[model samples]
Target: MRRLLLASCIALASLSGCASMGGASSSDIAAVLASPSRSADDRQRDARDKPAEVLALAKFKRGDTVADILAGGGYYSEILSGIVGPDGKVLLVNNPGYDAFGKKGYTERLANNRLPNVTHVVGPSDALGIGEGVLDGAVIVMSYHDLYWVDDKMGWPKVDAGRFLDQVVRALKPGGVLLVVDHSAKQGTGSAAAQDLHRIDEQFAIADFRRHGLQWEAAIPVLRNADDDRSKNVFDPAIRGKTDRFVHLYRKP
Candidate 1:
Protein backbone atom coordinates (compact mmCIF):
# COMPACT_ATOMS: atom_id res chain seq x y z
CA MET A 1 0.00 0.00 0.00
CA ARG A 2 2.81 2.43 0.88
CA ARG A 3 4.60 1.77 -2.41
CA LEU A 4 1.39 2.29 -4.40
CA LEU A 5 0.74 5.62 -2.72
CA LEU A 6 4.31 6.79 -3.29
CA ALA A 7 4.17 5.86 -6.99
CA SER A 8 0.84 7.64 -7.44
CA CYS A 9 2.21 10.81 -5.85
CA ILE A 10 5.21 10.73 -8.13
CA ALA A 11 3.03 10.35 -11.21
CA LEU A 12 0.82 13.27 -10.17
CA ALA A 13 3.85 15.48 -9.63
CA SER A 14 5.23 14.61 -13.05
CA LEU A 15 1.92 15.37 -14.72
CA SER A 16 1.73 18.77 -13.05
CA GLY A 17 5.19 19.62 -14.31
CA CYS A 18 4.26 18.59 -17.84
CA ALA A 19 1.10 20.69 -17.78
CA SER A 20 2.97 23.91 -16.99
CA MET A 21 5.87 23.27 -19.37
CA GLY A 22 3.91 22.14 -22.42
CA GLY A 23 2.98 23.88 -25.72
CA ALA A 24 4.71 25.62 -28.75
CA SER A 25 8.32 25.24 -29.69
CA SER A 26 10.88 27.78 -28.52
CA SER A 27 11.85 28.62 -32.14
CA ASP A 28 8.26 29.32 -33.18
CA ILE A 29 7.79 31.53 -30.12
CA ALA A 30 11.06 33.37 -30.81
CA ALA A 31 10.03 34.37 -34.32
CA VAL A 32 6.93 36.20 -33.08
CA LEU A 33 8.75 37.98 -30.26
CA ALA A 34 11.62 39.02 -32.55
CA SER A 35 9.47 40.90 -35.08
CA PRO A 36 11.31 44.08 -35.99
CA SER A 37 8.40 46.43 -35.34
CA ARG A 38 8.26 45.45 -31.67
CA SER A 39 10.65 47.21 -29.31
CA ALA A 40 13.73 45.35 -28.14
CA ASP A 41 12.69 45.66 -24.51
CA ASP A 42 9.22 44.29 -25.23
CA ARG A 43 10.70 41.46 -27.27
CA GLN A 44 13.19 40.61 -24.56
CA ARG A 45 10.53 40.62 -21.84
CA ASP A 46 8.27 38.20 -23.72
CA ALA A 47 10.82 35.75 -24.99
CA ARG A 48 8.16 33.22 -25.98
CA ASP A 49 5.52 35.50 -27.47
CA LYS A 50 3.27 33.57 -29.86
CA PRO A 51 0.15 35.61 -30.40
CA ALA A 52 -0.35 34.19 -33.90
CA GLU A 53 -0.24 30.65 -32.64
CA VAL A 54 -2.73 31.50 -29.92
CA LEU A 55 -5.15 32.81 -32.54
CA ALA A 56 -4.57 29.76 -34.69
CA LEU A 57 -5.20 27.45 -31.75
CA ALA A 58 -8.54 29.15 -31.31
CA LYS A 59 -9.22 28.03 -34.88
CA PHE A 60 -9.52 31.59 -36.14
CA LYS A 61 -10.15 31.34 -39.84
CA ARG A 62 -9.39 33.91 -42.51
CA GLY A 63 -12.88 35.38 -42.33
CA ASP A 64 -13.77 34.60 -38.74
CA THR A 65 -14.82 37.30 -36.29
CA VAL A 66 -12.78 38.37 -33.23
CA ALA A 67 -13.09 40.76 -30.31
CA ASP A 68 -10.03 42.29 -28.66
CA ILE A 69 -10.98 43.19 -25.12
CA LEU A 70 -8.99 46.21 -23.97
CA ALA A 71 -7.42 46.82 -27.32
CA GLY A 72 -4.98 49.42 -26.10
CA GLY A 73 -2.95 50.93 -28.96
CA GLY A 74 -4.54 48.32 -31.30
CA TYR A 75 -1.35 46.27 -31.44
CA TYR A 76 -2.82 42.76 -31.45
CA SER A 77 -6.01 43.97 -33.12
CA GLU A 78 -4.06 45.14 -36.15
CA ILE A 79 -2.26 41.85 -36.49
CA LEU A 80 -5.51 39.94 -36.06
CA SER A 81 -7.26 42.00 -38.72
CA GLY A 82 -4.49 41.27 -41.20
CA ILE A 83 -4.67 37.57 -40.43
CA VAL A 84 -8.46 37.46 -40.62
CA GLY A 85 -8.19 39.24 -43.99
CA PRO A 86 -10.55 41.83 -45.41
CA ASP A 87 -13.54 39.53 -45.13
CA GLY A 88 -13.34 39.22 -41.33
CA LYS A 89 -14.06 41.62 -38.51
CA VAL A 90 -12.02 42.76 -35.48
CA LEU A 91 -13.77 44.68 -32.71
CA LEU A 92 -11.41 46.84 -30.68
CA VAL A 93 -13.14 47.10 -27.31
CA ASN A 94 -11.83 49.76 -24.96
CA ASN A 95 -12.94 50.84 -21.50
CA PRO A 96 -13.73 54.42 -20.47
CA GLY A 97 -10.49 54.65 -18.52
CA TYR A 98 -8.47 54.01 -21.66
CA ASP A 99 -9.95 57.17 -23.21
CA ALA A 100 -7.80 59.21 -20.85
CA PHE A 101 -5.06 58.68 -23.45
CA GLY A 102 -7.10 60.52 -26.12
CA LYS A 103 -9.30 58.77 -28.70
CA LYS A 104 -8.77 61.25 -31.56
CA GLY A 105 -5.05 60.56 -31.79
CA TYR A 106 -5.60 56.82 -31.44
CA THR A 107 -8.18 56.81 -34.22
CA GLU A 108 -5.91 58.90 -36.45
CA ARG A 109 -3.07 56.43 -36.01
CA LEU A 110 -5.21 53.44 -36.97
CA ALA A 111 -6.83 55.41 -39.79
CA ASN A 112 -3.44 56.02 -41.37
CA ASN A 113 -3.01 52.26 -41.54
CA ARG A 114 -6.42 51.93 -43.23
CA LEU A 115 -7.30 48.66 -41.59
CA PRO A 116 -10.79 48.15 -42.97
CA ASN A 117 -11.63 45.14 -40.84
CA VAL A 118 -11.15 46.78 -37.43
CA THR A 119 -13.87 48.71 -35.55
CA HIS A 120 -13.72 50.49 -32.19
CA VAL A 121 -16.23 49.97 -29.36
CA VAL A 122 -16.07 51.94 -26.13
CA GLY A 123 -17.90 51.03 -22.91
CA PRO A 124 -17.62 49.95 -19.29
CA SER A 125 -14.83 47.62 -18.22
CA ASP A 126 -16.98 44.60 -17.44
CA ALA A 127 -19.36 44.49 -20.39
CA LEU A 128 -18.76 44.41 -24.15
CA GLY A 129 -21.62 44.39 -26.61
CA ILE A 130 -20.67 42.47 -29.74
CA GLY A 131 -23.36 39.88 -30.45
CA GLU A 132 -24.61 36.53 -29.28
CA GLY A 133 -22.90 33.28 -30.31
CA VAL A 134 -21.07 34.69 -33.33
CA LEU A 135 -17.48 35.44 -32.36
CA ASP A 136 -14.71 32.99 -33.16
CA GLY A 137 -12.55 34.18 -30.30
CA ALA A 138 -12.14 36.98 -27.76
CA VAL A 139 -8.66 37.87 -26.58
CA ILE A 140 -8.08 39.93 -23.45
CA VAL A 141 -4.50 41.12 -23.31
CA MET A 142 -3.20 42.55 -20.03
CA SER A 143 -6.35 44.50 -19.32
CA TYR A 144 -8.72 42.42 -17.21
CA HIS A 145 -7.39 44.12 -14.11
CA ASP A 146 -9.65 47.06 -14.89
CA LEU A 147 -12.67 44.89 -14.25
CA TYR A 148 -11.72 45.01 -10.60
CA TRP A 149 -12.04 48.80 -10.62
CA VAL A 150 -15.35 50.60 -11.15
CA ASP A 151 -16.70 53.79 -9.52
CA ASP A 152 -18.05 52.73 -6.12
CA LYS A 153 -18.81 56.33 -5.24
CA MET A 154 -21.12 56.54 -8.24
CA GLY A 155 -22.65 53.14 -7.40
CA TRP A 156 -21.09 51.63 -10.52
CA PRO A 157 -20.86 48.23 -8.75
CA LYS A 158 -17.99 45.80 -8.36
CA VAL A 159 -16.83 43.27 -10.90
CA ASP A 160 -18.75 40.05 -10.55
CA ALA A 161 -16.50 37.44 -12.16
CA GLY A 162 -19.45 35.11 -12.66
CA ARG A 163 -21.44 37.69 -14.60
CA PHE A 164 -18.42 38.72 -16.63
CA LEU A 165 -17.72 35.14 -17.70
CA ASP A 166 -21.35 34.61 -18.57
CA GLN A 167 -21.21 37.67 -20.81
CA VAL A 168 -18.15 36.35 -22.64
CA VAL A 169 -19.66 32.89 -22.90
CA ARG A 170 -22.84 34.30 -24.37
CA ALA A 171 -20.86 36.36 -26.85
CA LEU A 172 -18.90 33.39 -28.15
CA LYS A 173 -20.12 30.56 -30.27
CA PRO A 174 -20.10 27.08 -28.80
CA GLY A 175 -16.48 25.93 -28.35
CA GLY A 176 -15.20 29.42 -29.12
CA VAL A 177 -11.97 30.54 -27.52
CA LEU A 178 -11.25 33.03 -24.75
CA LEU A 179 -7.54 33.81 -24.67
CA VAL A 180 -6.15 35.75 -21.72
CA VAL A 181 -2.68 37.12 -21.23
CA ASP A 182 -1.65 39.20 -18.22
CA HIS A 183 1.06 39.85 -15.68
CA SER A 184 1.30 36.87 -13.30
CA ALA A 185 0.64 37.42 -9.63
CA LYS A 186 2.15 35.13 -7.01
CA GLN A 187 0.54 31.77 -6.30
CA GLY A 188 -1.95 31.52 -3.36
CA THR A 189 -2.31 35.33 -3.32
CA GLY A 190 -5.80 35.19 -4.93
CA SER A 191 -5.98 38.50 -6.85
CA ALA A 192 -4.46 40.69 -4.16
CA ALA A 193 -2.27 42.71 -6.53
CA ALA A 194 -4.81 43.01 -9.33
CA GLN A 195 -6.08 46.37 -8.04
CA ASP A 196 -2.76 47.68 -6.78
CA LEU A 197 -0.38 46.73 -9.59
CA HIS A 198 -2.63 45.85 -12.53
CA ARG A 199 -1.56 42.23 -12.36
CA ILE A 200 -3.66 39.14 -11.63
CA ASP A 201 -3.20 35.73 -10.12
CA GLU A 202 -3.34 33.31 -13.03
CA GLN A 203 -4.60 30.47 -10.85
CA PHE A 204 -7.48 32.56 -9.62
CA ALA A 205 -8.33 33.54 -13.18
CA ILE A 206 -8.44 29.92 -14.34
CA ALA A 207 -10.53 28.79 -11.41
CA ASP A 208 -12.92 31.71 -11.74
CA PHE A 209 -13.57 31.07 -15.40
CA ARG A 210 -13.90 27.38 -14.81
CA ARG A 211 -16.59 27.99 -12.21
CA HIS A 212 -18.52 29.86 -14.87
CA GLY A 213 -18.56 26.75 -17.13
CA LEU A 214 -15.49 27.53 -19.18
CA GLN A 215 -13.09 24.64 -19.64
CA TRP A 216 -9.37 25.08 -19.12
CA GLU A 217 -7.99 23.97 -22.43
CA ALA A 218 -4.32 24.70 -21.85
CA ALA A 219 -1.89 27.13 -20.21
CA ILE A 220 1.50 28.29 -21.41
CA PRO A 221 3.99 30.09 -19.23
CA VAL A 222 5.72 31.56 -22.21
CA LEU A 223 6.91 34.66 -20.34
CA ARG A 224 7.24 33.55 -16.72
CA ASN A 225 9.94 34.61 -14.31
CA ALA A 226 9.69 32.40 -11.26
CA ASP A 227 11.93 34.85 -9.42
CA ASP A 228 9.30 37.59 -9.17
CA ASP A 229 8.19 38.04 -5.56
CA ARG A 230 4.97 40.00 -6.22
CA SER A 231 5.88 42.16 -3.23
CA LYS A 232 6.11 45.27 -5.42
CA ASN A 233 3.41 46.60 -7.71
CA VAL A 234 3.78 45.77 -11.40
CA PHE A 235 4.35 49.46 -12.14
CA ASP A 236 6.98 49.93 -9.48
CA PRO A 237 10.16 51.36 -10.96
CA ALA A 238 11.89 48.02 -10.51
CA ILE A 239 9.29 45.87 -12.34
CA ARG A 240 7.38 48.39 -14.41
CA GLY A 241 6.81 47.29 -18.03
CA LYS A 242 8.78 44.10 -17.43
CA THR A 243 6.77 41.96 -15.04
CA ASP A 244 6.61 38.21 -15.62
CA ARG A 245 3.37 37.12 -17.23
CA PHE A 246 1.32 34.03 -17.99
CA VAL A 247 -0.54 33.27 -21.19
CA HIS A 248 -3.61 31.06 -20.83
CA LEU A 249 -6.10 29.82 -23.41
CA TYR A 250 -9.54 28.69 -22.28
CA ARG A 251 -12.62 27.56 -24.17
CA LYS A 252 -16.32 28.02 -23.56
CA PRO A 253 -18.24 24.82 -23.01
Candidate 2:
Protein backbone atom coordinates (compact mmCIF):
# COMPACT_ATOMS: atom_id res chain seq x y z
CA MET A 1 0.00 0.00 0.00
CA ARG A 2 2.78 2.43 0.87
CA ARG A 3 4.70 1.59 -2.27
CA LEU A 4 1.58 2.11 -4.34
CA LEU A 5 1.09 5.56 -2.87
CA LEU A 6 4.70 6.44 -3.44
CA ALA A 7 4.51 5.32 -7.05
CA SER A 8 1.47 7.47 -7.59
CA CYS A 9 3.20 10.48 -6.11
CA ILE A 10 6.23 9.93 -8.30
CA ALA A 11 4.04 9.75 -11.33
CA LEU A 12 2.32 12.95 -10.40
CA ALA A 13 5.64 14.66 -9.90
CA SER A 14 6.73 13.53 -13.33
CA LEU A 15 3.53 14.65 -14.96
CA SER A 16 3.87 18.05 -13.33
CA GLY A 17 7.23 18.54 -15.01
CA CYS A 18 9.23 18.59 -11.84
CA ALA A 19 12.70 19.89 -12.56
CA SER A 20 15.67 17.80 -11.49
CA MET A 21 17.58 20.92 -10.51
CA GLY A 22 15.16 23.28 -8.78
CA GLY A 23 11.49 23.26 -7.75
CA ALA A 24 11.03 24.80 -4.31
CA SER A 25 9.64 28.36 -4.24
CA SER A 26 10.16 31.12 -1.71
CA SER A 27 6.57 30.87 -0.49
CA ASP A 28 6.90 27.10 -0.18
CA ILE A 29 9.89 27.51 2.12
CA ALA A 30 8.25 30.32 4.07
CA ALA A 31 5.15 28.22 4.76
CA VAL A 32 7.20 25.36 6.15
CA LEU A 33 9.24 27.64 8.40
CA ALA A 34 6.13 29.42 9.60
CA SER A 35 4.60 26.28 11.00
CA PRO A 36 3.72 26.71 14.65
CA SER A 37 4.59 23.14 15.51
CA ARG A 38 8.31 23.74 15.10
CA SER A 39 10.24 23.89 18.36
CA ALA A 40 11.78 27.12 19.55
CA ASP A 41 15.29 25.67 19.45
CA ASP A 42 14.97 24.85 15.78
CA ARG A 43 13.67 28.31 15.11
CA GLN A 44 16.65 29.79 16.89
CA ARG A 45 19.05 27.74 14.83
CA ASP A 46 17.45 29.03 11.64
CA ALA A 47 19.33 32.33 11.92
CA ARG A 48 22.60 30.44 11.52
CA ASP A 49 21.53 27.46 9.39
CA LYS A 50 19.60 29.58 6.91
CA PRO A 51 17.31 26.62 6.30
CA ALA A 52 15.15 28.63 3.93
CA GLU A 53 18.03 29.05 1.51
CA VAL A 54 19.19 25.49 2.04
CA LEU A 55 15.72 24.13 1.33
CA ALA A 56 15.54 26.32 -1.74
CA LEU A 57 18.74 24.72 -2.96
CA ALA A 58 17.35 21.22 -2.32
CA LYS A 59 14.19 22.09 -4.27
CA PHE A 60 12.19 19.42 -2.50
CA LYS A 61 8.54 19.39 -3.48
CA ARG A 62 5.25 18.31 -2.07
CA GLY A 63 4.75 14.53 -2.03
CA ASP A 64 8.48 13.87 -2.33
CA THR A 65 9.72 10.90 -0.32
CA VAL A 66 12.90 12.19 1.34
CA ALA A 67 15.26 10.87 3.96
CA ASP A 68 17.10 12.79 6.64
CA ILE A 69 20.20 10.63 7.01
CA LEU A 70 21.94 10.71 10.36
CA ALA A 71 19.05 12.84 11.53
CA GLY A 72 20.36 13.86 14.91
CA GLY A 73 17.58 15.09 17.17
CA GLY A 74 15.18 15.04 14.20
CA TYR A 75 15.87 18.72 13.51
CA TYR A 76 15.81 18.50 9.75
CA SER A 77 13.44 15.56 9.96
CA GLU A 78 10.74 17.69 11.55
CA ILE A 79 11.13 20.48 9.01
CA LEU A 80 11.19 17.94 6.19
CA SER A 81 7.95 16.53 7.48
CA GLY A 82 6.27 19.89 6.94
CA ILE A 83 7.72 20.23 3.45
CA VAL A 84 6.80 16.73 2.28
CA GLY A 85 3.32 16.99 3.77
CA PRO A 86 0.90 14.15 4.54
CA ASP A 87 1.00 12.71 1.02
CA GLY A 88 4.76 12.47 1.21
CA LYS A 89 7.02 10.65 3.67
CA VAL A 90 10.22 11.57 5.48
CA LEU A 91 12.58 8.86 6.67
CA LEU A 92 14.37 9.94 9.81
CA VAL A 93 17.32 7.56 9.81
CA ASN A 94 19.84 7.20 12.59
CA ASN A 95 22.32 4.57 13.65
CA PRO A 96 22.67 3.48 17.29
CA GLY A 97 25.51 5.90 17.88
CA TYR A 98 23.48 8.88 16.71
CA ASP A 99 20.36 7.64 18.44
CA ALA A 100 22.21 7.37 21.72
CA PHE A 101 23.51 10.89 21.35
CA GLY A 102 20.18 12.39 20.39
CA LYS A 103 17.67 10.28 22.30
CA LYS A 104 16.24 13.13 24.30
CA GLY A 105 15.73 15.52 21.42
CA TYR A 106 14.25 12.95 19.03
CA THR A 107 12.21 11.45 21.84
CA GLU A 108 10.45 14.68 22.64
CA ARG A 109 10.20 15.66 18.98
CA LEU A 110 8.49 12.37 18.15
CA ALA A 111 6.39 11.94 21.22
CA ASN A 112 2.63 11.65 20.57
CA ASN A 113 3.28 11.08 16.89
CA ARG A 114 3.86 14.77 16.31
CA LEU A 115 5.28 14.23 12.88
CA PRO A 116 2.75 11.88 11.31
CA ASN A 117 4.54 11.72 7.97
CA VAL A 118 8.02 11.08 9.33
CA THR A 119 9.14 7.53 10.02
CA HIS A 120 12.02 7.11 12.43
CA VAL A 121 14.31 4.28 11.39
CA VAL A 122 17.18 3.11 13.56
CA GLY A 123 19.60 0.78 11.82
CA PRO A 124 23.26 0.09 11.11
CA SER A 125 25.30 2.57 9.09
CA ASP A 126 26.16 0.05 6.38
CA ALA A 127 22.50 -0.82 5.82
CA LEU A 128 19.95 1.85 6.58
CA GLY A 129 16.93 -0.34 5.70
CA ILE A 130 15.61 1.91 2.92
CA GLY A 131 14.49 0.04 -0.20
CA GLU A 132 16.30 0.49 -3.49
CA GLY A 133 14.99 3.19 -5.81
CA VAL A 134 12.50 4.21 -3.15
CA LEU A 135 13.44 7.78 -2.33
CA ASP A 136 12.88 10.97 -4.29
CA GLY A 137 15.55 12.84 -2.33
CA ALA A 138 17.83 12.57 0.69
CA VAL A 139 19.59 15.11 2.88
CA ILE A 140 22.75 14.63 4.94
CA VAL A 141 23.02 17.76 7.02
CA MET A 142 26.06 18.25 9.26
CA SER A 143 26.52 14.50 9.53
CA TYR A 144 28.37 13.39 6.40
CA HIS A 145 31.65 13.92 8.25
CA ASP A 146 30.60 11.20 10.64
CA LEU A 147 31.14 8.64 7.89
CA TYR A 148 34.86 9.13 8.39
CA TRP A 149 34.69 9.60 12.16
CA VAL A 150 35.49 6.74 14.52
CA ASP A 151 35.32 6.67 18.28
CA ASP A 152 34.76 3.30 19.86
CA LYS A 153 34.31 4.83 23.27
CA MET A 154 31.57 7.03 21.88
CA GLY A 155 30.02 3.94 20.20
CA TRP A 156 30.54 5.44 16.73
CA PRO A 157 32.17 2.62 14.82
CA LYS A 158 34.41 3.11 11.80
CA VAL A 159 31.84 3.34 9.08
CA ASP A 160 32.58 1.78 5.71
CA ALA A 161 32.27 5.06 3.84
CA GLY A 162 31.95 3.50 0.43
CA ARG A 163 29.37 0.96 1.50
CA PHE A 164 27.50 3.56 3.48
CA LEU A 165 27.26 5.90 0.48
CA ASP A 166 26.28 2.99 -1.77
CA GLN A 167 23.25 2.40 0.41
CA VAL A 168 22.13 6.03 0.10
CA VAL A 169 22.79 6.10 -3.61
CA ARG A 170 20.95 2.83 -4.25
CA ALA A 171 17.90 4.04 -2.40
CA LEU A 172 17.36 6.93 -4.79
CA LYS A 173 15.56 6.57 -8.09
CA PRO A 174 17.22 7.75 -11.27
CA GLY A 175 17.21 11.59 -11.27
CA GLY A 176 16.79 11.64 -7.48
CA VAL A 177 18.49 14.46 -5.61
CA LEU A 178 21.01 14.21 -2.77
CA LEU A 179 21.82 17.28 -0.67
CA VAL A 180 24.90 17.35 1.56
CA VAL A 181 25.75 20.08 4.05
CA ASP A 182 28.76 19.97 6.35
CA HIS A 183 31.47 22.08 7.90
CA SER A 184 34.36 22.73 5.54
CA ALA A 185 37.96 21.86 6.27
CA LYS A 186 40.93 23.69 4.76
CA GLN A 187 41.49 23.15 1.08
CA GLY A 188 42.90 19.68 0.33
CA THR A 189 42.46 18.48 3.89
CA GLY A 190 40.07 15.79 2.60
CA SER A 191 38.51 13.56 5.24
CA ALA A 192 41.53 13.85 7.54
CA ALA A 193 39.80 16.48 9.65
CA ALA A 194 36.54 14.60 10.01
CA GLN A 195 37.46 12.94 13.29
CA ASP A 196 39.34 15.85 14.78
CA LEU A 197 37.35 18.90 13.71
CA HIS A 198 34.17 17.22 12.56
CA ARG A 199 34.73 18.70 9.12
CA ILE A 200 35.46 17.53 5.56
CA ASP A 201 37.03 19.20 2.58
CA GLU A 202 34.33 20.46 0.22
CA GLN A 203 36.12 19.13 -2.83
CA PHE A 204 36.65 15.71 -1.24
CA ALA A 205 32.94 15.43 -0.50
CA ILE A 206 32.07 16.32 -4.09
CA ALA A 207 34.56 13.79 -5.43
CA ASP A 208 33.32 11.12 -3.05
CA PHE A 209 29.77 11.49 -4.33
CA ARG A 210 30.92 11.59 -7.95
CA ARG A 211 32.84 8.34 -7.43
CA HIS A 212 29.58 6.75 -6.33
CA GLY A 213 27.99 7.80 -9.67
CA LEU A 214 26.09 10.83 -8.45
CA GLN A 215 26.32 13.91 -10.67
CA TRP A 216 27.47 17.02 -8.88
CA GLU A 217 24.72 19.60 -9.37
CA ALA A 218 25.29 22.76 -7.36
CA ALA A 219 27.31 24.25 -4.54
CA ILE A 220 25.10 26.65 -2.62
CA PRO A 221 27.05 29.29 -0.71
CA VAL A 222 24.41 30.54 1.68
CA LEU A 223 26.05 28.99 4.75
CA ARG A 224 29.63 30.02 4.13
CA ASN A 225 31.16 32.07 6.94
CA ALA A 226 34.18 33.98 5.72
CA ASP A 227 35.41 34.47 9.28
CA ASP A 228 35.84 30.77 10.01
CA ASP A 229 39.43 29.73 9.38
CA ARG A 230 38.52 26.04 9.57
CA SER A 231 41.03 25.56 12.38
CA LYS A 232 38.85 25.05 15.46
CA ASN A 233 36.64 22.10 16.26
CA VAL A 234 33.10 22.73 15.05
CA PHE A 235 31.96 22.43 18.66
CA ASP A 236 34.28 25.14 19.85
CA PRO A 237 32.27 27.95 21.42
CA ALA A 238 33.77 30.54 19.10
CA ILE A 239 32.53 28.77 16.00
CA ARG A 240 29.89 26.33 17.20
CA GLY A 241 27.05 27.68 15.13
CA LYS A 242 29.15 29.88 12.90
CA THR A 243 31.42 27.52 11.03
CA ASP A 244 32.20 27.88 7.36
CA ARG A 245 29.89 25.29 5.79
CA PHE A 246 29.51 23.81 2.34
CA VAL A 247 26.24 22.83 0.71
CA HIS A 248 26.34 20.57 -2.32
CA LEU A 249 23.51 19.16 -4.34
CA TYR A 250 23.80 16.03 -6.45
CA ARG A 251 21.65 13.94 -8.74
CA LYS A 252 21.44 10.20 -9.55
CA PRO A 253 21.59 10.01 -13.30
lDDT of each residue in 171-191, candidate 2, tens digit only: 999999999999999999999
Find the candidate with the highest TM-score and give its number: 2
Q: Per-model C-alpha lDDT, please? A: 0.65, 0.85
Off by over 4 Å in 2: 1-22
Model 1, 16-70: lDDT tens digits are: 2322343223333333334334444444434345564554445454566888876
Candidate 1, run of 10 with poorest lDDT:
15-24
- Per-prediction TM-score: 0.74, 0.90
How far in Å is the alpha carbon of 29 misplaced in model 1?
10
Sequence-dependent TM-score of model 2? 0.90
TM-score of 1: 0.74
